[model samples]
Target chain A: MTKTRTMLAAFAVGLLTSTAALAGDVRIMWYSDGVEGEVLKDLMDRFMKDNPDIKVVIDNVSFSVVREQLPVQLEAGDGPDIARLANLKALSKHWLDLRPLVAEPAYWDKNFGDQADWMRPDGSNQISGFMTQVTLTGGFANKTLFDQAGVALPGKDATWDDWAKASKQVAESQQIPFPMALDRSGHRLTAPDLSFGANYIGADGKPAPLDDGAKGFISKFIGWIEDGTMSKDIWVSAAGSTYRAGADDFINGQVAFYYSGSWQVPNFSTKIGSNFDWVATGSPCGPANCTGMPGGAGLVAIKYTKNPKDVAKVMDYLASEPIVKEFSERTLFLPAHKGVIEKGLNFKTDDAQAKAALGIFVTASTGLSDIARKLPGWAWSDTVYGALVTRVSQAAAGEMTLDEAYSRIDADIAAKVKDSAL
Target chain B: MAEISRQTSQRRIGQSLGETAMVPVSLAMGLIDAPLRWVQKTFGLGGMAAFFLLPNMLIFGIFVLLPFFINFAYSMTGGTALFLSDRTFVGVDQYARLFDCANYLNPNTCAEDTFWTAVSNTGWFVILQVTLMIGFSLVTALILNRELMARSFWRAVFFFPVLLSPVVVGLIWKWILQRQGLLNFGLFGFGFEPHVWLNDRNWAFAATVGVSIWAHMGFYTLIILAGLQAIPKDLYEAAEMDGTRAMRVFTRITLPLLMPNLLVVIVLVLIRAVQIFDEVYVLTGGGPGTSTLFVTQYIYETGFAAQLRNPGLAAAASILMGLVLVVLTLVQLGLSRSRDKKGARK
Candidate 1:
């Protein structure tokens, strides 16, 4: 009886040891805006099933956690094997170059050719990550309000003034509180800034101080806030570089015109639910062109990963055409995959408004200026963004004049750039 | 004889129940007793006490003192890197940047304008908040000290906000003061136009201060209340026998006796008011163009929240703040000592 019991114990110990040896844990620090986390989980499950030796753990967190906390973890060399990051330029050094481990480098190069620069170090051709979703900034309007107020919606080449005039008329007629409301995000303001001919990148490809066009955009925005065309509560009420979304106002039909990005489409469609008719419009033209900011988040492998091959395998599976297509379709994201974009995703949304908005934003992305495409890659973009938000918001809040705001923005960015050498 | 038997059986049951409870405790003690006995035999009682305390001391040193030292070291360095090796040692440069103002009194003339703006805002906030908090807390404590209907219930009601999370308190106040919120609704019913309470800079600051006072006045009141309860009733009775007027008795007896407690409250409230962040952060976000910004907010933004995570600059700012706090604490201790000496003399 003792010998038999000893044999049973040995068998149990052996089973546990073998299982532990076989299993390799790959933790992916993830943050989500919508249903993408669920989609990624499903994809990861399939990958794990095929490669039974590997296990993937998704550490789901908030956007702010990803932005603030993950960097500290990475700097300490205790970050996850993989992470989903938005500020790619800021975290480019800590990203693992999966060039050698990837099954086929050609596939990654072809699929993520333009986005590779964003994930890699300056002037390096390495596959650090892939864009999960390519986002563009634009605006949506309350079509029902426009119709009721007898104001015609502007055409594709319509200028900022045209939209402003139309929105103001509609707001006055319908007694809407905010004629126009914008999210208090510097990134959100990029569309109008670029449209107004902001030269964020100088001739030398360095981040230039706010040009006349950028100042023009700020001036117009401040003018709107002063004249009651735009609401101060959304922009001026909050201080510093704090982000404030106007989704509530837009959904409640309080805002006739809401300026945000393509990311808000899925949210608006689901949350609004036929409350009012809202439609995505072309980015209003400024002195330069009708343009928008091209930006997105990347799913990256960390440099400190012990299991490079396993991480690569997971990335390969997630970046496969079928998986990415399904992810983009389900999440209603504009696909970063060239093949998926070319084929055109069948967005799995029943809402007509969402479908139309997605179509409009995708087309708008094609017309993004060279400067706009390159702005996301610049190391100093975040510095520029911070200065822009702080100074511009202060000006909008009536704390300082526009000139003081402009001078402060220039000084702040200059000081930051000098201190940023690491 | 039946009652005696019943009592004897109950005693046996109680004994068995206690034994049952002690079984696990005895086993745990037995497990550790051997090691403890060995330690005491090997190193004596003094060493044993130290050995027992070593784990907690090590934890505190590692978690608290180590980080504080590192922060101090980082304050003397410059650069954007999180690690020390990657950072450049620019001794006192960050400090210079912070203090390099043409006119320190006017934040607009300062090199680091935002820091000075925060200082200006925080100075006003600390002065107003501490004064008001102490005054209201004292008044409420005096009121609650008197015999009244539902005194305990009123005490609980006043102390309820103190029990609430700062975030919850901020959210509640924000909801009440928003443009389309309860306050505005009441104003509308009164045939008055709705005021943009949070949008205006002055109004936003005033609102945050008001909410802060309401939320925290209860804690100070509770402290004073305890102090009031501890005061000897004989003193009040003597004052009454002397035919002292109510106001004079309060001034001569209650105020003098409550001085120590009041000082404690003042110092604690001042420190708290200086360190205010979460409540004001959630309420105003230091907004309406930095009119409500505080030093803590500046440190937070410079350290972690900003696009440029300049820990060096943040550490410098924090060290300066620490020096100020240390000086204030020393002053508070001096005053407390003096008060104690006076009481002893009396």
Candidate 2:
């Protein structure tokens, strides 16, 4: 946290003294789920105190509202200096060009090191923005429950099928009501594909471009849930709070294994660290190697910038160890830098298993962009997930078989593709 | 004959000399007045009226009228925030897009669901709300008018919701309906599953309507009570003497007397009902797939949400809705006029 504040202070100073014509006031539009808005305010105050020539104004809107309103405000000529956006769908439509703004690529590479490839969604040499932090959603298991069920962690040799078998054993033990709880939220499904080097089709902006070995892995992950190894009811929330409730149920000893993204790591450690021991691992893979779901929002400078040079400098500094480490340590997020994690931040968990999980994420997936953003049928995925969950629930209730559920989802996907001939 | 002719000529000569100067003076006055009359008629009175109403008119024009008109214009243009540099002015495109949204977003709503939802929701609300509000107040006024119980205490109790803020009402109800909230605690005590009332579609809709009634009924109740008290008691007394009973007297006299107040109440309630925004926005946010999404929320979504940054489309929808409401109001006015004529005939 101290590192984070100091880094913010330094970054603010750089922003203040830089060449800004008319010492123009920068109105930044941002979003707030919690203390992010407050942290931005702190950053602003530090900037304004040093410069005093330029005033920094902040308008924090809801995440969903900001998502919908950013383009609207920009069109109306009322957008802020900076905004936070979820990296969703292809940058094909709302692409930003930071090439002309930032420091030269050689200099950026010297400072940021090898970790900047994750920022380029299109995989082009064009670095649109700098990622503040990175997070990957994989599989997390409870060590205590694993021991109680007499099941062992699937090491490097084991695959997802073995993991499911172990999970089935844990469920048969029944002390844990559910063996695995799968989060069917749009982003996390990519984790299943990533565990075995697969990507959601259309995630990358191209035609019929599925990952190296995706279809088989997708079927198995779907099979695990459909085969009763994982329960959709434990994780899915149509209107109720779905995110924490799964972890809450798991932490409270209702479930054995929880599958979710890296965002809720703090929530898990804070809530359940003292009571039960847990293990985090690269999700067990289906084939060659374990992988992770790769998605992170980047801080892009708008084309209508007053000082592209300065904005580029800030981006460069933000990618630097001094800035990125501070942002990570204070924000309780995974550092985007390579050696920063070696010099630890505030990941206060006593359990060795949780530490192992963090290590797995670091090793499992190269900091690469997932393909779902460019996928043609994100709407289709929603329809599929919605339909699949309903059918799977019916199957769980003895209304259909595993084969029947899979066939239904497969048919829907095919039909959706045909309709979208788009 | 010579003497009479001389007298007549003498009189004519005298009259012509006296009145001849007045004719040219009158002609000049009329000629001078013509341009002054035209200028005053064209600019002065009209300008002053506009000037007097200008502050409000300008405010209405800038905030409400301009936004509505501009939203319609922009909806046609299909311009976005990031692409204003290369925006095209496409006409009637947004109205066509509304059908597209209806087709994709809602199968049933393609024709006029968005507009009609706001209308029917407002309509049903007006009917039940006005009837219940007026009825409760009338009953209370009757009881208070009677030599009976603590009228002031009950009046305050009923009117308390009117005093509390709607935001406060929304927040309090939100707290009460949350998963671990007061409602769930009660449900748990009775061995029932604690439903997520505010989050669910059907329950969320009901809760919004319920909160609306709870917050607004108090004001309407007070107004109806005031109307009820103003009715003359002699007619009721005379009816009672002539063997007409309580219900009979209420229908014949109290109701007839209250028509003017009732008409005012109806119009105000209808107007207010058409523009229900805050509670719904703060409450459910039109979630669970837009089951409770009203026209105002939809317009806000289109204009400001950046979800679909075609303000022109939102503006077109608004104009259409405004026209619908205007026509509906005119019909209400026509009904009231007929009622007045019938009352005068009686």
Candidate 3:
């Protein structure tokens, strides 16, 4: 018995010693739309090879999981050391201020510029992280369908009604089932919503959603749905702020016009090759202005991580000019790094359509309204967006009248803001 | 006579094998009893039971009871903060928010209309899903219990869908029911218009209920089948000997004998229907303007799905849902007990 006990104790001690020998591990919670996750993994592999004392684990999670699970995990003090997050304003408090820890703070300020401020709460000049890809929400059309239908493509300054009429004509002529579809995201909808002169953020810096401009846009949107210019499938098919992508419908050549964003450029470039001619255009006009929303996902280091220095190291490497350039060129993302953007991305795409689409989106980014730029960085932007989409969707589905929806949007946004108390 | 003697010999052999197998088991029990007996002597029978149950009790208390109490505490707080320290104690504000309606029946006049919509949808879903689920299960159980060819194979086939994950079941049905899906294709082939199954409000709600029944009918059928087997053969035999009809026999014998199991199925299906999330969520996502949204989906969305996670509001909604479930379970149990007494008296 004594001999057996000694053997067990020795085995346990050896197990503990073996476990202690391995280096400290850092987990990066990541999600990808295309190839960015793979690009980051490749970069991290190089980091691991050089710095063998630190191990990095890339937890490839879904976008929904990142949105729904990451905040809960962060609040519980058990989030990953680094994570790719889109809802930066919502999770601003939990971000580790990388300015103090990064290798060269000036490099971030120079390249990222005002982009880093989007991840900071309340417009404070604290640097949190750099943008993975600068995204501009806009519209794309099946130009082939338009040509076949002999319906002329609406120009840059065309009104929303003009685009709708053109798209409907194209669909009718070609027998396309869905004339228009938009990504069922509240953020995506804001491009058009803001064009109707709806100032989502009031002068007092609160979400006041029910201004006359907003009501006019929502009422027009409801009219479009009723008239079948926009399919209810993408808008009213899901409930209560649930996001549904219409990329498949667009790619399948079943939809004549799809309103999504620049983030879809790579996907459409790859998937719709030699199938249908698609084009990304500037935002269609409303009464106020023709502009799209400027938004992007960020890779922020979490505050509660045990290895802040290691995380900073990874961030610095990723934010390096060469790495950022290569990542943007390969992933077909607009470079957030000012130097990379100025140096001109040798955007390695042979597809003329993709190149043209990129040019249009880049131009559109410049023409975005000041409100669009500020909306993404606002603290309660999500609350404002969520309230608008949920109530407006209900109205579109005929569950409530337009007046009731506007009132509800106002009440819901107010309640949500008060409830959060941020 | 030869068969009977062979069976008697086989029974003796089985008894001998059973005794052989129990030797080590009995020895192990004897070894365990020494400490147990000492404990009992020192304390009492209650102490012995308590000692035996300590591990399970600790597990339940720490995991189940702890979370439940935490949820109760969370329901009293407010804010999008996930941690209790970050939350503000709002007392009954969350509950009040949920119950703030102009008319109890009209969800349209409510402050938090989504919650009421979910409740109304769930109420309709339960009424429809439970009734149809029970009826179909009973019918399937009766058919399977017959002296049909390949009965076991048919039984297995009926229970096959139950083995699949809820997500899988939902996806399979979704693929069949989508706009360009097999059902539409087949309908087009048959000279019919392709109807949108999941995109239409009423159709989406119906599809959710129908797919739920298809996925879960097998489980309840298995239960009812077991109960059908437990019914006495002699009662059916005597009924067959009489001039009683098939309908009368089924009504008198099979249904009455199956009441206890039927009650179990009803209560179980009721609780499960109220807790329905995974299947309907995957199938419809409570869509076409919240027509198929259930209370559980509402709670989940409030707490997690949204960018602003309102755990306090979600917790309050969940507690109210729990109260509803508790009331349903009590009513079901009372009905079951009363029926059992009536059966005993008979």
Candidate 4:
């Protein structure tokens, strides 16, 4: 009888201690583009050493999980304590407001204030999250390929046509498959669209129809695919708005010019590594303006977290000026923190090309169009983007006419809007 | 005399130990025996059968029937919400939207053009895949059933793909088909121009059909081979004795005997062809402009993968696909019943 009593007592104690331990646990769902996962893990280890009572666990996952699965998890009111998300504006309602929970609301406001609206509900002063990096959609040129082909890289004020023509020349001379290849992503496409003076927003603050500016660029894009000036493999390889990057083709020297984004800096720095020379060309000029879309992934606290206080602590530590500066430097990500940006970062990389590319992206960030600036916080941006990618790819594949694709884009966005209506 | 006595003593001890081990089992039976007896007395033997089936029925209801009902409910609602409680009831509006087409023939006229395009693609895929799958599987099975050298090795070679995961099958074929892949290298070596096989619409569609057939034909071949082996060998012997031609003998004896298996294979192949997604999705990603897009992938992307998902629309599309599968299943059941009835008559 005494032995049984002791066993039951031990079990009860174990359960109580485990529950207490779990109460302090903070889980973060993270996805990385480059070596950021490792950088963050190192920082997290240091954080745990300092705050032993508050356990921080990082769940490393693919970008697809963050894009596709995390939204579903959030919708079901079940997810990690925090998540690093790219579609921050669309899922803003599910985020925890750290204004009350954080140690100093003014600190957060002064540091992350500029981009806070991009990850919170409209008309709310909620300090929801902070952008881990500031990304701008742009172009990268394979300098080695151009050099091998005896073709000079286009000038700074070069138009999309000039770049396309020059890249095609280099591709032909080098006997490579793709002259130019843009990532099969809506965000990537929008840089060129905005440069062509495409306005995605209307007077009602809803998605506008595909205007002449958008059509002009898209029609040209489709023609390039048809004429083999652009890589058809990237665009038509998938259907229905599925994202595919042409970085591999570019890295492999098959593509002369690749249009992706600033986020590919570290990825190319790590993967391309002296195999070939590359340089960021920023976005090419259009009839309207030379511009690129402004966007990035943000780390946000989920409202459904049981350990809100612990989550706030972790967020506070990660959002500190010194920590953000260190993270940006080590990961080679462009910092979004105002203080960190003002202080300027010495990006920790030996790759001259990567350093130059980072400098180019920072310069490109200043030339962003007004529409591009607003798009990151716009609720209907993703809706428009999804429609553009789906229909434009179809047109490129000769499945439909460019005019039909434009019509379909409008209809698809309208349907999405209606479907989202309460 | 002492050894025999010792052996008898050992045998007695073993028996005693066996009985002692059964004590717990006997006690367990005794504990439940009374309740079981009472249940049988109150409800009769028919109810006892149902009582025994209760656990499986409960599982089926919770996992299968419950989700199915919830899915049907989702079909009747509209919203971007993942949970049913948060969604608004739209009462078949989602289905109406799917059917809201200016012209049924051209997907361009449909409100949901991608869905219609997928349906058309799936239809073509089913016809080509089912016909070719049966023809190839039947031929392979016949070849394997013959008295050939390394017969077991040949069977294993044919059955290898069936054991592979669909994703592995897709990746293997993709490596061979992509630009700069082995096929292109071989073509270049042979002084022929290398073509991008997966980038062209016609080639992409054909690849999806061909790859799916390759991945799945092995399983069907094994089934047909089993049916082939089950045939009475003496029938072939008698045909030879009568100086019957090979073709005539096969048409008369082999095909007649294989009819039941063939019917089963046809139904199975047809059903599977309609439900195809994973291997094809990985292979073509429903592209070179939605040319390889199928019904299952359409439902998946609409519900889950899209930037702003419409679960209601996806659920409606799924319910429609389910109805098509239901009709296919009924046909299979009818064919199976007729086959059973013919056996009964015989």
Candidate 5:
């Protein structure tokens, strides 16, 4: 009887202890593009050391989990205390207003103010989150391949055609598999679409149909795939709005030019070390302008967090200027914080190429078109992007014509809008 | 006399212990007895069978029927909302959208072209995959049934792929078929030009079909093998005594006897082909344009994966797919019933 009583008491104590632990726990759902996961871990260790009462746990997952699974969790009113998310604007309602929870709202406003609207709902000044890093879609060229092929790189104001021609020449000389390759992503495609003078946003603030500029660029893109100027493998590798990157082709030196984005700098630096020289070519020019799409992943606090105070504390520590600066420098990411940008960072990288690539992305950020700048904050942007990727990939695979793809994109977007209507 | 008494005491202790262990079980039955008796008395013997099946029925209703009804409910609603309560009712609108084609034959004329494309692809996949799957499985089963050397070893080798996870199967085949994969490497080594097997539409479709058959044929082969072994040895012996040719024996005796199992396999293969997703999804991702896209994948992407997912439309598409599956299941049941009747007559 005494043994039974003792066991019951011990079990009660354990239950209480677990409950206590839960009360102080703050969980973060994180996904990394490059070395940011490691950098974040280091920063989190420091935060945990400084705050002994709170226990911060980071759940590292793939980008797809954040994209596909996190939304389901959020809709069910269950998820991690915090999440590093790309689709911030679409999921704004599920974000906790850190304005009331954080230490100083003004500090967040001053440093991360520019991107605040990107993660929050329109018509409200809710401090939902801060951008972890600013990203710009651009092109990366295999400089070593060009030099080996005895082909000169295109000038700064080079059009897409010029780069394509030069890359084709280099590929022919060096016997590379792909002359040029673009990521199988709508965000990556949008930069070129914008450069070709496509405006996604209509006058009524809804997504417009694919314009002549978009069609012209898309037609040319498909033509490139047909003529072997652009790699057909990546574009037709998957169906639907599934994201696939041509970074591996670029890293393996199989492609002469790869059109991805700035987030790939650390990835390329680590994977392609000393194998070949590479350079970041800022977005190629089109008829209207040479502009890249500006977007980033935001670290937002989830509203469903049981321990809101602890979550706020963790968010505060991570969003601090010093932490953000260190994270940006160490990870070779473009800082989204205005203060960090102004202060200037001596990036912690041995690779001279990565540093130069960062500089190119920074320079490219300044040339973002009005539509590109506004798109990251738009609610319907992802809807538009999903439609674009699904149909364009189909068209690229010769399953449908470009005209059919355009009509489908418009119909898909319209259907989504109608479905979303209250 | 003393030894006898001691043995008797030990026996009593053992019996007591057994009785003690059975006390709770006895109590449990006692607790159930009154309710069961009441049910029997109220509804007779026919209803007693249903009463005995109550728990299973409840489970089936909760897990299967309830969700199916909820899914139907979802089909009638419209919204980006995940919860039914948060969604708006738009009765049959989603279905209308799906059937909104100007020309039923051409997917491009349809409002939901991807859906029609997926339907068309699924139709072709079912027809081709089922036909080829049965043919290969039968051939393999026949070969395995023969008294060949290392027969058991061959059987294990044939069945090995069936044990592997669909994802693993897909990844394995992907490694063999990719641009820089072993197949291309082998071709290059053999003084042949390497071809992109997955990038072409026709080749990609064929890969999905072939890979699926490779992954699943073993199980079907095993089933057919069981059917082959069940056939009486006397039939084959009589055919041999009459000097029947191998082809004649197979056609006259083996094929007729195997018809029931073949029917079962055909229905199962058709159902499985229609529901094919996991291995093929991992293999081709319904790619080279929607050439390999199936109904299941379309439902998944629309319901869960896509940005601003339209669960309503996915639910509607799923309902249509479910109806097809239901028809196939009914056909299976009808075939089995007919087979049973024929067996009873025999």
Candidate 6:
């Protein structure tokens, strides 16, 4: 009996020692949207081969489905080891110190890799995101429609005022209901408003409420509606988004343009095959500068993870230049890593059009990340920006004036702050 | 003999309490006996039966009762009263916040304010849906009450949708309600233009209502079918002697007879509609810009959406919803009793 007890104890100790040596599998909660998730799966497949014991369990939920389910899971202490969060707001409630996990500063600095300081969880000037993809949303033009209208192709130097004039001319020439079909989504509507310079939230170093930028953006926005260059009917119409079937609508000459995110390239490349030409470009600059909404998913670790070092190692692998290149290039997204311009996705078949899209990003005067517009839950931007879309659409339909719509949206945003403050 | 009798008592007690409570159920089931014997042999007494019951109470307290009490605690606070630990305890603030509405978005419609609008919309839906459900089900049950028709065939047809998952139902409805869907195709064939059912605010409500009715009609139809068959045929025969026609017999006898089953149907529909997140989620996604945004989805968005995870506010909203549901159910029960009294008096 004594010998058996000793042997069993020795066996238990042996098992524990072996467990200590083995690299533990990091639990990853990666939710993908569109093509990024598929690309991520491919990257992880390679990572697992490199570290056979370090398995990554990728739970890919629909973009919206995970948004709804994440907070509850995080709160319940059941969140994945790492998550691919599309918006920065994912960092607000749950944060992990990623500084130590990230490659040395020398490596990051030498590469010219820059993720704006605001992406951090604590918002105290630390890099938190493992990766970020460059997204150009808010301006896409149908080449066929422009060619049919005999409109001159838009140049890089075109300002918002110039673009608006050209767009109106194109619409009049084509005799379509309206040429540009920019969605009146709160985020889309307000991105132009903010990029034109609106002081939405009361962050330090920003202007006071209802600042000059806000007034300017609103005025330009209202003018766009009144001029009928942009139509509310497009937002309300039963058209396909840049994906699925509705994309064919713009390609087939039902509408002149479809302004959506860069994700549309893969769908268009496949479906819009030789039907019509198209170009993705930066948002129109008024007098200030041309800016586009910079957003893409980031991988983040949970706060209370036990084996954080191993988890960080897994995250490091995900954010490596090799994997980042695989993702960005396959998906045709702008690389989150610095100096990765030459290494990105081949989402489009047409090299010329792809260059046109990439050229717009490369030449953009500025890039701002205002991606919170799409993620609905607990998001100040979506709440405020969504209200702008709702009320503005109402205003565009002649239900209210632009001034009324702005005031209502401001009031709604303020009300949200008041409710969310607690 | 006493040991056998005691064993039987133990088994019966264990089954009943074990069936209900799971801990006292152990004692009734004799899981307590082993521990009881261990304690008895160690301490030379069986008085630790109370001690043996402690684990059950502890598990129940930790899992079930704790949440219930904490929810009650959070109910008293305003804005994120949930207890994942960060929320401050603000007494009566959550309950009081419910009363404030001047700051509400749609000033013209107080009754149509976010929470109240959800309430009335949910109420109206429950009414229309439940009435139609019970009415159609009761009528089907009447038809299938006898061997006159193929009862099983008709029951299967009515019960088919009940077997279908809510997600499938929502998806099926999405395809049907799309502008180029079967409904539109038929309308186009009849020389009508295609209309976006889920797009227009006016028609969006109708679209949701139609989906709800289509998805749920089969469930209650089956239940009412069962209820109709269970009604004693003597009552119908007795009423027929008064020179009553089939319609009159149904109105006078069948309607009153199916009230209990109808009440169950209403309760189920009300519970289901108030929690109507999934179908509303898939069909409209609360758009043409939030015309379809129900309170449940709004609660989820407010507290848990990726950008904004205000769990305290979500808990506050949930507590508020729970109170409102409880009060509404109570009021419903009270009114139902009053109606029963009036019926008795008549």
| Candidate whose DockQ is highest | 4
C-alpha RMSD values across all candidates: 4.1, 14.4, 2.4, 3.2, 3.9, 8.0
- What is the RMSD, in Å, between candidate 4 and the native fold over all Cα? 3.2
Error of 2 at A57 (Å): 5.2
Best by lDDT: 4
List iRMS for all predictions: 1.5, 8.9, 1.6, 0.8, 0.8, 6.2
Clashing pairs in 5: none
Off by over 4 Å in 4: A1-14, B1-37
Docking class of 3: medium
Model 3, B1-346: lDDT tens digits are 9999999999999999999999999999999889888999998988989998999999999998898889999999998888888889999999999999999799988988999999999999999999999999999999999999999999999899999999998889888988888999999999999998887888889999899898989999999999999999999999999978999999999998899999999999999999999988888788878888899999999998876778999999999998899999999989988997997898
Candidate 4 vs 5: which has more DockQ: 4
User: Which residue ranges in model 3 land beyond 4 Å of their true spot?
Assistant: A1-23, B1-20, B46-54
> What is candidate 1's lDDT per residue for B33-148, written digit by digit as tens?
99999999999999999998999999999998898889989999887888888899999899999999999998777878999999889889999999889999999999999998
- DockQ, structure candidate 2: 0.10
Can you give the DockQ of every candidate in the order shown? 0.65, 0.10, 0.68, 0.81, 0.74, 0.19
For candidate 2, write residues B1-346 as lDDT tens digits: 9999999999999899767978898899899788757766788977757756879999899998877665555556655433423556667766765554344443234433434444445555556555665566566656766665777887787789878776788777877876557999999999997876754556766776677767776676667667877887787778878998878787888787777777766666666666667766665554333445667776775555522234555677777778767876897899789998997898
The 0-to-1 C-alpha lDDT of every candidate, in the order given, reads: 0.88, 0.59, 0.88, 0.93, 0.92, 0.62
Clashing pairs in 4: none
For A370-391, candidate 1 gives per-residue lDDT tens digits of: 8788888887787788888888
Residue A126 CA displacement from its true place in model 1, Å: 1.3
Tell me which of candidates 1 and 6 scores higher on DockQ.
1
* Candidate 1 clash pair list: none
User: Per-residue CA lDDT of candidate 2, range A1-422, in tens?
Assistant: 99999999999888776645335656556664334466557766765676666566677776555555566655544455555665322222333456666656665555444434443444456555655556676777777878877888677646767777787788788555567776634356555555466544454422233444544555555566556677544322222111223666676766677777565565566567678777676665655555555555556555565645555554555566665666665555666565566676654446555556666676655533444333322323333433344334333433345565455445534533432331
Error of 3 at B291 (Å): 0.3
Give the lowest summed-lDDT range of ten residues in model 1 chain A. A199-208
